[model samples]
Target chain A: EAGVAQSPRYKIIEKRQSVAFWCNPISGHATLYWYQQILGQGPKLLIQFQNNGVVDDSQLPKDRFSAERLKGVDSTLKIQPAKLEDSAVYLCASSSGLVFSYEQYFGPGTRLTVT
Target chain B: AQTVTQSQPEMSVQEAETVTLSCTYDTSESDYYLFWYKQPPSRQMILVIRQEAYKQQNATENRFSVNFQKAAKSFSLKISDSQLGDAAMYFCIWGANTPLVFGKGTRLSVIA
Candidate 1:
C-alpha cells in the first residue's frame, strides 16, 4: 500500500513570508493529522481531521497557522507571516481509526526553514 | 492535558549490544495507548511498537520491546542486539481520545 504523501519535501522562506504544505493520505484512511516537529522534539499535533471535520486543533496557532482537509482525503496546512520559531519539519500522518488502534502512517515530512 | 516525557536526550550503544530509552507520562485517563516511533535521518516516522493500557504483557516486535508500567505511568523502549541501522530519534507518545502527545524524543546512536 502506498504511504502518506506530502509535497515540497523542503521549503525555505523568510520570516513574515507565507508558505503552505500539502498532504495526501493513504487510500481509504479516514483520519488525517498535521504535526510540527521542532529540532530534538517529537512531532506535535497542530490539527486533526476526521473526514474533513476537525477532531482537534487546540494546539494550532490561530493567528498564523491554518489547515483544512477538504473532501476528507487531501489536506493543506498554511502558515502566513511566518516566524523564525516556525522553522521545523511539518509532518502529515493518517490512520485507519479503528478502536484500540494507534498505528499511524506518516509522510516523510516537509522541512520548513524560516530565515 | 496529557504529557509525555523522555528523560534521556541522547543514548549510545555499540552494535550487538542492548540499550533502553526511558519515558514517563502523566495522564488521568484510564484507557490510552503508548507508542514508540523511530525517525531516522530520512525523517520518516516509523512505528517501532505500541502498547495498550489494558494489556499486561509487553508489546514486542522483533528486537524492539516496550516495558509498560501503567501504575507508575512509565513506558520505556529496549532495543536488543542493536544494529547500526537502529540509530534514530525515538519518540515516546501518549495516545488519548484526542491527538497523540509526544515527548522531547531520545536520539539513539549505534556505534559499529
Candidate 2:
C-alpha cells in the first residue's frame, strides 16, 4: 500500500503572499488530517476531514487558512496573505479509522518559509 | 482540553545502551490512547509505540516499550539496545474522542 503523499516538499514565499499545499492520502483511508509544526515543536492539528466532509477545524485560522477535501481522497490547504509566523512544516496524515483506534500514516511535510 | 508534555528537550544515549524519554499528559477522559511518534530529519512521522488507557499491560514493540502510569498521568518510552537509527525527534501524543494533542518533542541522539 502506498503512503500519504504531499507535494512541494519545500516552499518559500514573501509575507502577505498566498500559498497552497496539496495532499494525496493513502487509498481506502477514510480520515485525513493537516497539521502545522513549527521548528522545535510538535505538529499541531489544523484541520481534519472524514471523507469529503469536515470533522474538526476549530483550531484553523479561518481568516487566512482554508482547506478542502473535495473527493475525499485528496486535499489542499491554503494560506492567503501569509504571515512570517506561518513559516513552518505542514504535514498530512491519513488513517483507516478513528485516529485513537487506528494508526495514522504521515507524509513527508512541506516546509514553508515566509520572508 | 487534553495536553501532552515532554519536559526533556534533548537526550543522548550510547549505542547498545538504554535510554528513557519522559512524558506527562493532562486529560479528563477516563478512556483514551497515548502514542510515541518518531520523526527523523526526513520529516515523516512514524509510530513508535502506542498504549491504551484501559489496558493494564504497557505496550511494547521489539526494543521499544512504554511505561504507562495511569494514576500519575505519565507515559514514558524506553528504548533498549539503542542504535543510531533511533536518533530522531520523539513526540508524545494524547488521543481521545477529540483530535490528538502533541508534545513539543524530545530530540534523541545515539552515540556510536
Candidate 3:
C-alpha cells in the first residue's frame, strides 16, 4: 500500500514571504493531520481534519498559518509572512481509524527554511 | 492536558547490543494510548510500537518491545539486537480521543 505523500521535500523562503505545503493522504484513510517539527523537537500537531472537517486546530497560529483539506483527500498548509521561527519541517500523516485503535502513517516531511 | 516526556535527549548503543529509551507521561483520562515513533534523517516518522493503557501484556513487535507501567505512567522502549538502521530520533506520544501530544524526542545512535 502507498503511504502518505507530500510535495517539495524541501523549501526555502525569505522572511515575511508566503509559503505553502501540500499533502495527499493514503487512499481510504479518513483522518489527516499536519504537524510542525522544529529542530531537535518532536512534531506538534498544527491541525487535524476528519474527512474535510477540522477536528482540532487549537495549537495553530491563526494569525499566520492556515490549512484546509478539500474534498477530504488532499490538504494544504500555508504560512503567510513567514517568520524565522517558522523554519521547520512540516509533516503530513493519515490514519484509518481513531488514533488509539490505528497507527498513523507519516510522509517524508517538507522542510521549510525561512531566511 | 496530556503531556509526554523523554528525559534522555540522546543515547548510544553498539550494534548487535540492546538499548532502552525512557519515557514518562501524565494524563487524567484512563482510556489513553502510548506510542513510540522513529524518525530517521530522511524525515519520515514511523510507528515503532504502541501500548494501550488497560492492557497488562507489554506490546512487542519482533526486536522492538515496550515496558509499560501504567501505575507509574512510564513507558520505555527496548530495542534488542540493535542494527545500524535503528539509529533515529525516537518520540514518545500520548493520545486519547484527542490529538497526540509528543515528547521532545530521544536521538538514538548505533555504533558499529
iRMS, all models: 1.9, 1.4, 1.6
Across residues B64-108, which tens digit of lDDT does each residue of candidate 2 receive?
999999999999999999999999999999988647889999999
RMSD of 1: 1.4
What TM-score would candidate 1 get against the native?
0.95
Kindly report, for each predicted structure in the order presented, the TM-score of its chain A compared with the true chain A: 0.96, 0.97, 0.97
Predictions: Cα RMSD each: 1.4, 0.9, 1.1
What TM-score, over all chains together, does every model reach? 0.95, 0.98, 0.97
- In angstroms, give how far residue A88 of model 1 lies from its true place: 0.9
Tens-place lDDT per residue, model 2, A26-106, is 999999999999998888889999999999998899999999999888999999989999999999999999655688899
Cα lDDT, all candidates: 0.91, 0.94, 0.92
Candidate 1 chain B TM?
A: 0.97
For every prediction, compared with the true complex, DockQ reads 0.67, 0.76, 0.75
